[model samples]
Target: MSSTAPDQPSPARTPQARAGHALADAVREVEHHVAAAGWDAPVRVFALVRTQAALAAEPGLADQLTPDVLAAARADDWHLTSVEQEGLPAAEDLEQLLAALSWPDAVDGVAVTVERVVLPPEAEEALPADPAEALEQLLTHPQRQDVRLAVGVLRTGATWCALRTRAHDADDAVAQGADLVPGLVAAVRATLD
Candidate 1:
């Protein structure tokens, strides 16, 4: 007898699939942590490291993590630990900021979350060409929408993104996919290279 019905596919069992799931989970966790801090926050970056290795390097860290986190870390050798990058130097734009970032070999993956004012396509036509004026227009435009984009990428090239709009602030309303923000994914992926 077949182990699984033909119509019902089996769950992802490959190493890459597992890594993808782990990376997505890590990205969502980071996004939720940032969301809890409220909106209008600065661009936040985090390095994803293997929890098992982290624990092996510093056994005292186990005391800092919650029971759930510790349990999960113990259960999965590939579990990731998010280490926030603080004291980041100021940069003019997301592109500039990401361009200046580089991770050590120890880092398994990286994530970045940032808020942006999104304007409808029609409203974009009326905005001034100057960067500062355009931002001012976007900030005050009646049709403007605020969105927080969280993107994560592993060294193996797996990518996942989460987008939360200010209008739909609920956790369940957050959107998740591998290509939600391709530009951001590419930028974050570049840092891992």
Candidate 2:
């Protein structure tokens, strides 16, 4: 008698895997909403969401803002106003801002992921000498592997925003993400009004 081999077991799904899937689904939902609303500016929305994630990673960074960064982020001007107003800085607002910035582009949706390195106090001094080296050290740290740095922004004339980062990941993304929202919101709101 011939017998077939037993079936192999499937690999277990980790929490990160599950979370990523959920996030992707959420992005899809946001896309549906934007499409239905027919809002122009898809790149703006994606950029705003990315900016939100960046600011959330580095809160209070804006307080230390300079003209150079501002010029680089002129496309995301709303962040400047939000920084000035001390707004709650919603991801949705970023989406609206994106729409405003990229008017007539028709933003259907946006999803993004970012990875960052946090500089330690000891490393701060080295930043001026060789910033890239410091960043490499932080990124390669054994303790930093599991960290997740991300920001999700959804908009349909109205916007919704959420900021999150993994524990192993440095709090940099959180602060950065927070700092970026104000300028992003201000820039977008200006166009809407």
Best TM-score goes to which candidate? 1
The ten-residue window of minimal lDDT in model 2 covers 77-86
Misplaced by over 4 Å in model 2 are: 1-105, 120-128, 140-146, 154-193
Q: Global CA lDDT of candidate 2, please?
A: 0.38
User: Model 1: per-residue lDDT, tens digit, 1-193?
Assistant: 7698787645675557777888999999999999999999999999999898999999999989999999998887778889999988689988998999998999999999999888888899889999899988888898988999999999978899999999999899999999998888988999988
Q: Which residue pairs overlap in candidate 1's backbone? A: none
- The reply for model 1, stretches above 4 Å from the true place, is 1-11
Q: Write the per-residue lDDT of candidate 2 for residues 63-178, one digit (tens) a residue.
A: 66576654544443222212111222344544443453432222222343323345456655545457677567666765443222223433433333333334522222333232
lDDT of 1 at 103: 87
- Candidate 1 global lDDT: 0.91
By summed lDDT, which 10 consecutive residues of candidate 1 come out lowest? 8-17
| CA RMSD of each candidate after superposition | 3.1, 19.5
